[model samples]
Target chain A: MSSQAFTGGHKASHQELPPEFQDQEESIKITGFWMFIVTDVLIFASLFATYAVFVNRIASGPTPAQVFQLNTALIETLILLTSSFTIGIAIWAMRQNRQRMVTWWLVLTVLLGMAFVSIELTEFAGDVAAGWGWHTSAFLSAFFLLVAAHGTHVTMGIIWAVALLFQLRRRGLTTVTRRKLYTFSLYWHFLDIMWVFIFTVVYLGGRLI
Target chain B: MHGGDEQHETAIEPGFDFISPRFEEPKFPMHQVWGYAASLVLTFAALWMTVNRIMSPSVLLGVVLAMAVGQAALQLGVFMHVRESRGPAWHLVPLGLAFAIGIGLVGMSAWIMLFKSGVS
Candidate 1:
């Protein structure tokens, strides 16, 4: 389908668009990705709603203020935020057809993402070893579910970035590859946006009186 | 009309084709740099406000939530290129509706569960 879309562009593309949108079908695919993001928005919304409900339900365990560490969460937040900026810059480089710049920035972004996931895992491990698991209370359950979901998304993103790096190597910058990278950047930024809320409503809100 | 029949069909064709395109003028990404800086400021401000208890608890919560929304908007526009389109920007319609529903879901759930709410 992608090859077909690429070929279709050369003859019929009247509108000068970014390389990703040079193919009409691929532009529709971009819109489809947006729809996918809309669904994701709802998915996270439900979890956030659940988290809000259970946030105060510490049956026999620590409260969020007791469990969450401001310093660590702040570091993780900044790392992920910087990775988001790096990916945005990567896409900017892709538009200019600078493969090396895009590749270097993507590598940096992936490394940052790995750092975030590892830090989160270590945090969770520390909690579990100290005997605070999701089973401890409704609040813990909600916290784990909401945050783990985002962590899982980040894990998946790391994998996707590695895969995209491979594709960029094999295919160089084509319309198809450009679209894929652009969509991934969109997903990354969306995740950061979600994290902004998580940092606010979950981490920071947990520290509130 | 170079082709009379083509022009005739255009006269009869529906205008609801959403596949319209727009030019994406390339420039230096100062937007990204400013967005990153602004986002950092917002994060630290939220943290500081939370830590210092600079306002009443509820008011601080409200302020931080507003900042989160602003940060999301900044990333969406500057980084995600939400307004750039090869289509009619129909995405903004669904994405907007999604936010409305998502925000309503979070706010309503928090409000409804006020029965279980208290200090951290």
Candidate 2:
């Protein structure tokens, strides 16, 4: 069973790990992705540190109370959360071998991700238009650095997802495609968790003081 | 023995023991649905508490940060399928350590940098 290709729909385990971890090499790749996530955690940790350290250093520029739009941040958070759930469903559908359902769920996740990024970009553009650029102060710089870094990751995830859709179409639900989708869901969920911290630390915490 | 949608254990192997990863896809995504609801609640509860100034500043920060941790746990457990693996779940070792170190870095950096306000 370890060497046999799974025709999934039952349980996924050592011998039936869906298509993603259906083999040793495939699961090892999955583990490598987790290691990548660990590194990402450290990267974000340092960025969070920078943001916290510089938050109070407004240096005669716009304070978070002035620049932070609670409404926009709330919208972005909600969108990302929903997208995370959708990607979970997408993977579930993949395991169930419901190809069409998987496709629909992935499409929904991508659209939601696009909406989240759009709102974030609009917020940034609004700030810049009002002369509250990242260059204005240490606080703004840290804020942009942390957030734009997350936004850039979201952008990359979107590209990865779009490319994955093409792969799914081309390769169908082979072990390769399933592994790719599984990893993409992990990446998507990781981004949502990062956004959770951002909302708590940057947006809500900004108004705490 | 040949049912289409029966719950099953691994028969391909002779031994079943603890610490071995198990996987199941239920008829409904109970974990995911509940996790989604819980996350939304945590997100808004934190937002409402902070927006209304329901607590002192320090306590509010602590509460929201704790909620953020809760959200992370939900994503890791429910969405990421962190426990579902083919091996001994070795990935959690590095990930757990990273969380400890990462949290320390964030906390220490904040504490040390606050002294700049005192200097100025």
Instruction: For residue A189, give model 2's deviation from the true position in Å.
Output: 0.4
Q: Which ten residues in a row have the lowest lDDT in candidate 1 chain A?
A: A2-11
Q: After TM-score superposition, what is the CA distance of residue A2 in candidate 2 from its true location, in Å? A: 17
Can you tell me the CAPRI class of model 1? Answer: acceptable
DockQ each? 0.43, 0.41
Model 2, B90: alpha-carbon shift in Å?
0.6
Shift of residue A87 alpha carbon in model 2, Å: 0.3
Model 1 misplacement above 4 A = A1-14, B1-25, B116-120
lDDT of 1 by residue, B1-120 (tens): 132112111121256343332333345768789989999999999999999999888889999999999999999878988865653567887998999999999989988877544653
In model 2, which runs have C-alpha deviations exceeding 4 angstroms?
A: A1-13, B1-20, B116-120
Cand. 2 Cα-lDDT? 0.85
Worst 10 residues of 2 chain B by lDDT: B1-10
Q: How far is candidate 1 from the true structure (C-alpha RMSD, Å)?
A: 5.8
In Å, residue B31's CA in model 1 sits off its true spot by 0.9
For model 2 the TM-score comes to 0.90
Question: Over the stretch A1-209, how does candidate 2's per-residue lDDT look in tens digits?
Answer: 22233334334434556656656677788999999999999999999999988898899898888989899999999999999999998887787777788888999999998999999999999999999999999999999999999999999999999998888888787888889899999999999999999999999988986
